[model samples]
Each structure stands twice: as structure tokens, then as C-alpha cells.
Target chain A: MALTIAIHSYKGGSGKTSFAINLASAYASVGKSVCLLDVDLKAPSSFNYLLPEAKHWVNDIFEGRYGVMDVVKDVSKEMGTKGAFYVGYSNPDIVAVRGISSKDRKWQSKALKLLMTAKRDLSNAGIDIVILDTGAGVDFTSVNAIAVADYVISVGRPGASRQRLMEQVIGGVYMPLDKDCYIIENMCHNDNPTDLSGKKFDLPVLASIPCMCDVAVRCDNEVLVLTEPDHAFSKKIYDIMESLDKITS
Target chain B: MTDNSSTEEMIRLLREISGKLDRILIQGSADNESDDGILDVLDVMTLLTLPDHLRTTATALFELGSATADELAERTNKERAVESNYLNQLVRMGHVAKNRKGRKVYFSIGEGLGK
Candidate 1:
């Protein structure tokens, strides 16, 4: 069975998208067929990194103009992966973003159904995992991604306020949906300690990655997990994957 | 297409689904063996016909296969009474079947929702 994971956050600037991309890269490097979807339609930055070229974007799939297969692009050769790495990028144009964001509840409801169908299609294509890079907050897009996911990894910074926001979302959304949720304390400073124990939150803290100034400042779409496997940040990413395997298994 | 056109399209689809659901219910009512109202097989499109609140409940039930309201409550993080009402609503819609096994009431997809 293909496991669908949604990397989500209650707020932005928490390294959610980067973690999602690297997590997908890590799995592909290990010969697991993975499909990373840039479902954060309003702020699609995956295109800046993956630089995928396709005739159809993910926006086309939701609009009933095309299906998942029509937009899926394989970059296994480019990424030098033993397994296939496919991506379904969303259109990053301002007009496209506004259009998708302005969609009504009816359209969003239909979009959710389309997403479920897309999940099945990806699984049928032999994908081992499907990772959704979701937008922050309780928007329609985020909820749809959460609804279809088997697991959700919520990324947050180390702070009392951020922790409170994380707790509210977990209690209000993840708990209600009965999702398997894990927390990643991203960009933790030396002075600000992240509670690794599960008592801090209802879910387990998957990892507490410290602030690497050189890495945190780099604006490039460099996937350190694949390029620099020996790096401390990369090791933490792998550790997170190991923890996920144990829990899921 | 504009929002107006999209809204119109959604209405059209809902009408089509409603017609299909009506036919399924009537045929199921006639074919039911145990005299337990309409017993039918819901397909994937059934998800689209449900409202957001009911959709969430139905989705959880679909994942659980068959469960009591209390079991569904635990999974959905809703009160058992709320889940019971939702399950009853699904039963009325012929999308789910209700059974009494001992003292507990179990609700399951009518036949199967295409897995």
C-alpha cells in the first residue's frame, strides 16, 4: 500500500516545504518510488526547486481539465535515484494562485474527491509513498490534504506561542480526523529548547533540528538529504524516517 | 471557467448523482432479503454527494469498515451521540446499514464503497 503523508504547519516559515522535499528525496534515494505533490497552491515554491517541465500542472487536475497521470513528471535520472521520483507541480502564476485560492466550498469539495482519486492513481502507478507539501493554517487546501493523508507531520518552531498553536490544531483538526500526527521542531535556537518528550504535545516530537545559520540562510532549493547525506541535518531527516518506519510497521 | 460556470457545473453533477442514488435506493429496497429497508452498494462518487460535515463522518466510517458509534467517536474525535446521529442519517440515505448485534448498534457501508 502506498502511504500518503502530508507535511503541514499551523503557520508558515517553519521549514515545512523544505522538510517535505528532502523527505521525498531521502525515500527516493533509498530506491522507494515516491511522488511529491506541491499542493500548496497559493504559494507554490516547489517549482523554484524541482524545476519540473510538464504540459499540465496540478491545477489542471483539480479543474477537471486533466488527470493525475497527465501531469506526473519523472525525474529519477536527473536526481540519480535507483527508484523513480515523480512530481506533480502546481502552477505558480499569480492568476492561477488567486483563482485556486478564490475557489468556493463546492469547488473545494470536488477538489477533495479529485485528490482521493489522484491518490489511488499514484498508488496504481506503483508509488511507494505520496508526500503532500501543504499550505499552513486551517484553509480548505490544508484540510483536503490532511483528509487524504495516512500520516501528518506538523513542523513548528521552538517557542511557547508556536507550541500553543500546534496544540490547538492537533486538538481541533488532527484529533478530530483521527490522524497519526508527529511534530518536527525546526529552526530551534540554542537558547530555546524544544521539548522532545511527548508530554509537551499530544503527538511525538519526530525531531528537533537546530538552526544551521549557513543552511537556514541559504535560499536555494538544495536538498541536503540527497546531496550531503553526512550532514547533521541530513542525519536527522533519516532518523525521522526510521522513527516513522517503526511506528507504521 | 468562472465561478458561476463552476457552480452551475456542480449543480448539474449533483443532480446526476441524485438521480443515480434514487435508482440505487429503489432497486435495493426491492432486492433486500431480510426486510431491512434499502440495502445498496455505494460507489466512489458517493463522497461527492455528501456535505462537508457528513462527508467527514462518512470518510471515517469508510476507513473503519464497520464500527459502533462509540468506536467511530474515538476515531473521529466527536461525541458518541453526534456520531450516532450522523450514522443514522447515512442509514436513512441508504449509504449505510444499521445492525443490532447484542446490545450494541453497528453501522457499516451498505455493501461496500468500492473499497
Candidate 2:
């Protein structure tokens, strides 16, 4: 079974999805069979950042026109055989899918089934890990994705709201599941070092990623982390992967 | 019903019900199993009267069990409390066991539960 890691945060704009894509790509660069699933149905940005191959299978799967595996394309081909990388494509109009009604019980049930199916397909494709990029906030979709993961990587920026959201998620959600959830502070400015420390945020800080405009611009252009490992952001992503390996192993 | 058909149907239903219950459990809802006496009732139900459908599914879930709440949460997208309660019920009923190594609670199917 592939280790399913869900990159999630309760608050938006915390670089959750971007970290998921970059981390998945980083793992792939090290010869790990990795698949990045864009489960953030309302805002599916992983496809735009790491798998902009102009073709995705998400629409096909949603419309009952294709299996999920048909859309798992190798985006790492451009990185020269460093490792295997595949992105599960999603339709840009995925919000229109009938199974996307977050409040509907039928939709929730169907979405869970879809997740399980996606996991099976990804595993069968020899993916060693599946990184799920979840939507922000404590919605049904995010909860369902986190519930089914082997590891929950809570990504957030250092802020009061972000810290509170992390506490709510970890205390109310992850703790019940008894999961090994780790917190990652992204886009940390050097001036604010005590942002997440002390009695306020008691959760372990797995890694801190510095804010890098160049990396953000490249991500906006749909670039992979391995494509520029020497970059500051890429190195930060590499450190996260290493930390994850240490904890998971 | 034929024995084979009944067994299959039971397993199917158990799988669906267990999946549903598993979702609720993963969400970290406070099931009324906190009282030791109530816990005993749940254990009896699980051991004796739990529908065949639920039995099969619960067995499968326990068998392919996660070692940590984090692992289970990562797999199910559920909150920690929900998963803990579900695992607690299983543990109380002797269907699951928790291995405490250092600070972590690793859950797996109990050896007593015939696999």
C-alpha cells in the first residue's frame, strides 16, 4: 500500500497545495514512485503548479468518460529520469461535478468512494506515495481526505488565525484519529521568529520554509521543485521531505 | 437463505455499515462509550449481535489497521477524536489492541481476534 500523505491547513493562503505538489515532486526526484492527487475540488491548483501538461484526466473521470489511471501523466519526464512522477489530472470545471456538493450526504459518500478508488489505482500504478492537496478549512472534503491518509502534514503560515486553525484541526480532528500529524510553517519571514513558539502553539514545528518570491513566481509558471533544486524554496522543500522520511520511517 | 449467500450478503452489508461507522468514528464524534458499563454493552453487541455486514467490514478494517492515529487520520481524512473512539471501542471489545511504545499508541487487530 502506498503511503498517502495529506497536505492540509484550516486556513487558506498557507501554501498547503503548493507544498504538496513540490514535496511530491521532491520525492519523485529521489527515485520514489510518487503521485499527487488534487483533491481540493473547489480550488484544484496542484494541476496548475506541477502537472501543467495541457492534458488532465479529472474531467474524464468526473464525466464517466475515463478511469482515474488514464489521467495520471508523467510530469517528471522533463526532469530527465531522476525518478518517476505522475499527477492525477482534474478538470478545471470540477466544481460542477455532482459529487462536489459538500453538504450532500450522497456527495460525501461518493467522494469517499472516489478517494478510495483513486488510492487503489495510484497504488496499483506502483506509486510509493500519494500526496493529497486538500482544500483549506474544516470542510467535509478536507476531513475525508485527511481521515484516509497515512500521514497528515498540516501546512500553515505563522499567524494568529493560522495557529488557531492548526490547533482546532490537530486538537479536534487529528488527535481523535490518533494520527502522527506534523506541522509545517511556510512563508516565514526572518523578522518573525517567535511566531509559532511558546505556550500558544504547542504542536511540533516540523520545518520552516522561508518566503521566496522567485520560487513562488516559478510555481506560478507550473515548475517542479527538482527542476531547480539549488533554489532556496527547493532546498526548503527537500528539507521537508527529509523530515517526513525521518518521522515516517 | 443459503449459507453461502447469507455469508456473502452479511459480509457486504458489514462492509458498508463499517465504512459508515468508520467515517463517523474518524470524524471524532463522542460516542456514548465513555462509561465502562456502556463500553461493556458495546463490546457485547460487537461480539454477539453486530450484524454480519458490520462484522465483516469491522474485521477487515481491524485487519488492515493503522498503527497510529496520525496514520489512520491521514488515510481517512478524519479527526483524531473520532478515530480514537472507534479504536477504543474495538480495544474494549478485544477486537483491537494498542501497542504503547514511548509516546505513540500503535493500533492493530488483537491477536485474540481470529484473523
Candidate 3:
């Protein structure tokens, strides 16, 4: 069975997508069939990072325009890596982006069911893990995605509003939903203290990643962990993946 | 540390960050800035839009497991005829599942909306 992990944050610009891609690549590196899905339909950046040489999109699969299997692009060959590393990207087209956020009640239920079916299909495809990079904050896209996840890694940055919202969301949303939530303090300034797992938040702090310009540059170009495995940022990504491998196994 | 102190520190950090802005852009937490309103097909189905009696009936069935229209009438305080009409609407909406047993209509929240 595929263990679905959702990388979420209460606000944007928290390195949420970057971590999702890094973790998925890490799992693939360890000889696991991994699929990184960009469910952040409104403003998807995963397609920009991962090589999107495929035709079908995640939005098409989500909106019932295409089958889940049809949209999954086998990216392991392109990335020059081993194991299955597939990417199901969201539609970056202007018109299609506007249509994915459906509000109809009956349609919402069916869409939820579709996501469930997609998970089953992914598992049937022998995918070891399905990592979802959802839209930031508590939209239905994020909320529903988080609800379905087997595990959640909430990415956070050093800010006031972001921190406060993270606290409230954890207490009000995640706790009530009975979710296993782990916090990752991402893009930390070098000057700040690390090891905030329990000192700062109520949940287990999975990893503390320092702000690195090299990773940011790669994020703008290619998947950082895959392109430059020797980089410090990439090392942290591997460390996180190693920790996750233990927990999920 | 107590959750209250941690929460206070979080509020202080929030204020400190907002203080760096050239001018006030946003006030309070972003939780209130939910754009997930009923503007599109993907936004969550609003529970607020559901009829009060239908919601009550669903809640009653959710707690009771399954109840006949007459049993629901006593719990929801609606007459048999009135309760059955609402029950039929809920069944039509798929909010409640109906089973027939010797002219009695038992309703319970089922499938997608039940949980």
C-alpha cells in the first residue's frame, strides 16, 4: 500500500513544495517507487521544478478529464535516477487553473471520492509512497488533502502571522481531525537556534533546515536534491527522508 | 512551557513581523482570510446552506443509528406527516439512506455525507 504523506503549511512561501519534491526524490533514491503530486492547482510550482515532459496533468486527473495513470509521468529516467520517481503535475494553463476549485456540494463529494480512488490506483501501480504538495492554508484543497493523508509534515517559516496560524491550525484543525502531524521549521536563518521540535511547538519537530541560496537557485531551475546531492540543503533533505523512512516503515 | 505562553510568544512574533511592513497590509490571523468561500466548484460544501430541519434530522439519525419517521418525529418534535416529508427530501439528497420495513420508513445518515 502507498503511504500518502501531505506537505502542508497554513501560509505560502514556506518551502512546502521544495520539501515535498526533495522527500519524494529521497524515497526514490533509496529504491522506493515514489510519486510526487502537485495538488496545489491554483499556483503549482512543482511542474516548474520537476521535468514536465509529459502531456497529461494532475488537474486533468483530479477533474475527471483524464485517468490517474495516464497523467503520471515517469521522471526517474529523465532525472538519471533509479527506482520509480513519477510526477503528476497540475495544469499550469490559465483557463484550466480557474476551473479545478469546484464548489458544488455533490461535486465536492465526488471529487473527494475521486481522490480516494486515485490513492487506490497509485497503490495498485506499486507506488511505495504518494507525496502531496497541497495549496497553503486551509482551503478545501488543502483541508481535504490533509484529511486523507496517512501522515502530514507541516512546513513553517520564521514569521509572526505564519507561526500563529500554524498553532491555531494544529490545535483547531489537525488535532480535531485526529491527524499525526509533524512540524518542520524550514528556511531558518543561520543565526537562529535549531532543535525546536518540542521547545517551541506541541508536535514533534521533524527537521530544521537552514536558509541556503544554493537550494533556492536550484528550486528555480531543477529539483535540488536530485541535481546536487552533495549540497548541504540536499543533505538535510536526506536526513528528513531517513527519519520518515523509520516512522512510516 | 504552557500552551498559553507559547501562544503569547507566537502573537508577539506575529506583531514583530507585521511591524517590519512599510504599512499595515493585513490585520489579525490569516485564518480569517479564508478565500475558500463558495465561489467555485472545489470550495467545500457549505453546511450552513443546508436546511435546519434536514440538518437536525441528519444529526438525529447520526446519533440514533437508524430511526423510523415516527421515532424521528418524537426526537425532532415534528408530526409524522411533516417528518416523513423532510425524511424523503433527505433521502433524495443522499444525506440519509432509507430502508422499508412493513410500511415503516427508517432513515439513517449514510455514504458520503454521513461522516
C-alpha TM-scores of all predictions: 0.72, 0.65, 0.69
Q: Write the per-residue lDDT of candidate 2 for residues B73-99, one digit (tens) a residue.
A: 555556767667767767777656678
Query: Candidate 2's error at B38, in angstroms?
Result: 22
Greater DockQ among 1 and 3 belongs to 3
DockQ metric for all predictions: 0.05, 0.03, 0.07
Tell me the tens digit of each residue's lDDT in model 3 across A84-203: 988888778878767766444445545555676687789989999999898898776776677567888999886655677888788666665456888898988866543434544568
Q: How would you encode candidate 3's per-residue C-alpha lDDT over B1-115 as one tens digit per residue?
A: 9999999999999998878662455533333333322222222234224556765565455435678988988987889888899888877765667888897767765444322
Q: Scoring only chain A, what TM-score does candidate 1 earn?
A: 0.95
TM-scores of the candidates, chain A only: 0.95, 0.86, 0.92
Q: Tell me, by TM-score, which candidate is best.
A: 1
Docking outcome class, model 3:
incorrect
* Candidate 3, pairs of clashing residues: A101-B42, A102-B40, A102-B41, A102-B42, A103-B40, A103-B41, A103-B42, A160-B14
Q: Give the best candidate by DockQ.
A: 3
Top lDDT hit: 1
Regions more than 4 Å wrong, model 2: A49-56, A59-66, A94-99, A194-202, A222-224, B1-115
